[model samples]
Target: MNKFKKSKEIKKIKKIHFMLFFIAFIIFIFLSFQNEEDILKKLDENVTFESIHYTGTLEIIRNNNKIIKTFECWAKNDLFLIIFKNPEDNGVKYLKKDGNLYVYFPSADDVLTISKSMMKQGFMGSDISNEDITRNRKLLDDYSIVSFNKIIEKDNIFYELTLQAKTKDVPYFMQKLIINSDFVAIKTEQYDLAKRLVKTIIVDEIKKFGSRYYPVKVTIQDGIKTSYKTIFSITDVSFNIPIDPKIFTIQNLYNK
Candidate 1:
């Protein structure tokens, strides 16, 4: 009778251990999927817009030298048009449509297609690259979340996400993204294929446009040049506005 009682007690303890392990496993899976979905939703919310119009001012600073450029931008779906308004770059235009980038030089009165090789180069001597302006895709489309966690710092809550590129075609192979509670990207650190940090983007301010929060001021820093940085400020912005389809056409690239 004593032996039977001991055996029963041992079995009961083993069952309890198994149940605890199962519960832990389920919780782990739930959190893993839940966090990924939450991050994806936040990213999509920030980027989604039927159409948008904004006036952007760019301040490029290299060491002690600074240059300012202003432009009017309109974007819808995969199409966007940028027209420089500053005197130095006046009438110069860039149009992105059907996965291709086209530039119109006002002085030459010509439109030229930009090749993929040129996308990595600086845009008009600014720290920002051509790709940076033309890339309209969501980050999750090219990246897989490696890990994510909610962190609190300086009385603000942020979601820190580690992401790895799904393929080698992406410029940044890895990224550490920080998004605030408003679903706005507060900062992003981009890494190369070798896991070396290549660039960083920080959002300085955000404003609400209708129901969405948009970044009004941002700074981009290239890893190769510590002294080089670009500050992009959006002075006027409107989202979900009706835009004419002809505005994004190649023929309209040179039109005012």
Candidate 2:
């Protein structure tokens, strides 16, 4: 009877150990899957613009304070229809369609097409170039999030996300983006192949337009020599406004 009781106690101990191990394995698998699903959901929710249109005046500064240049810009979608109203150059327009970009230079009476090599060049000596404007990649489409953490901004809170490109065509392949909880990208840091800081973009003066928040002022700082800053102050902005597709054509660039 004593031997039988001992045997029964040993079996019970073994069963309990096995059950605990099994439960731990199941819990690990569940947590891993949940984490993956959360990442995909966050990427899907990153960029969600039904439609956007805005007109704003811009000023480009140097060394964070010196006024380098200024311009009045009108943009729709990813296209700049009217540029170079202030400063010097007149009636210059930048058009981007189907991933191809072209510049209409009214001052030179010539239309110069933009090549992939020139994508990094500044637009009219300003901090923002053609790539910065047109290469607005959707997080789900081109990048994979490596990590996400909280960051405190001056007036609000944000998530600092480290992302790496999943494709070769992405211009800013490796970047760290500061995205607000509402999915607004308030800041971005781009790096070059040598892991050097290439550019830093800051969005400020956020104002409520319709039901969404829009940045009325934007500043892009180049980390290289001749630091440039571009400031955009919105005069009028409306989302889902009636815009004809023809307004995005290259022919419309020269149209009065």
Candidate 3:
């Protein structure tokens, strides 16, 4: 009788342990699924602004805070028309389409297509690149969210979103975007195929243009080059203005 009682007690303990483990496993799966669902909801929310036009002056600085380049930019939708206004490269025009880019030199009167390998290269010795300027923001159309979380910056008020490329042709296979409640992209990190950090862009000096806020200044840093910093400042801005579609074409580069 004593042996039988001891055996029964051991069986009860084993049963309890099994039940506890099963409960924990269920909770873990539930939480993981919930987190994924929340991220998808956030990404699906409306975040686009009304159609607008903007013009700004960009200043580029290199290592040692030396002024390296400057340009005047006119932009609408995903297209930007730039004229190098300083360092004797003025009146040049460039066009970015999808992930491809082209530059037209007035002196040569020729338009040259930029190679895909050169997309990561600096634009006219500035910190900005073809990818940075031509990044498509139609999140719902181009990419999908894999995960998202809030990141506390200096003020402890910011949100960071991580997105995985849905297609193989995307310029950067993985991307992390940081934005505030206002849907302004304060910072963005790009990753390559090996999941290595390639570039980081910081947007600051936000100002309200019309009813929406826009970043007036931006700084881009390459992880491979720690000492390099490219600062772009917007000196003038206009929003919600009319822009002709022809302005986005290469032929319109020379149009006032």
lDDT of 3 by residue, 1-256 (tens): 9999999999999999999999989998778756544543443332234334444455554456666456666566566667777657877877765556879888888788888788877777766777666775555455676776766778765667787888876777788887775556778898887999877889877876555666778877876877777777767566646767677787776554
Write down the worst ten-residue block by lDDT for model 2. 39-48
Question: Could you tell me the TM-score of candidate 3?
Answer: 0.70
Tens-digit lDDT track of model 2 for 111-226: 78899899878777677776876775556677776776766768776777777778777766678877775556778887765667778878886776555666677777776754
Which 10 consecutive residues of model 1 have the lowest summed lDDT?
34-43
What's model 2's TM-score?
A: 0.74
- The regions of model 3 sitting more than 4 angstroms off are 1-59, 97-100, 151-157, 254-256
lDDT of model 2 at residue 35? 57
List pairs with backbone clashes in candidate 3. Answer: none
lDDT of each: 0.88, 0.68, 0.69
State the displacement of the C-alpha of residue 75, model 3, in Å, after optimal TM-score superposition.
2.6
Query: What's model 3's lDDT at 93?
Result: 78
Best by lDDT: 1
> Distance (Å) between predicted and true CA of 160, model 3?
2.7
What's the C-alpha lDDT at position 143 in model 3? Answer: 64
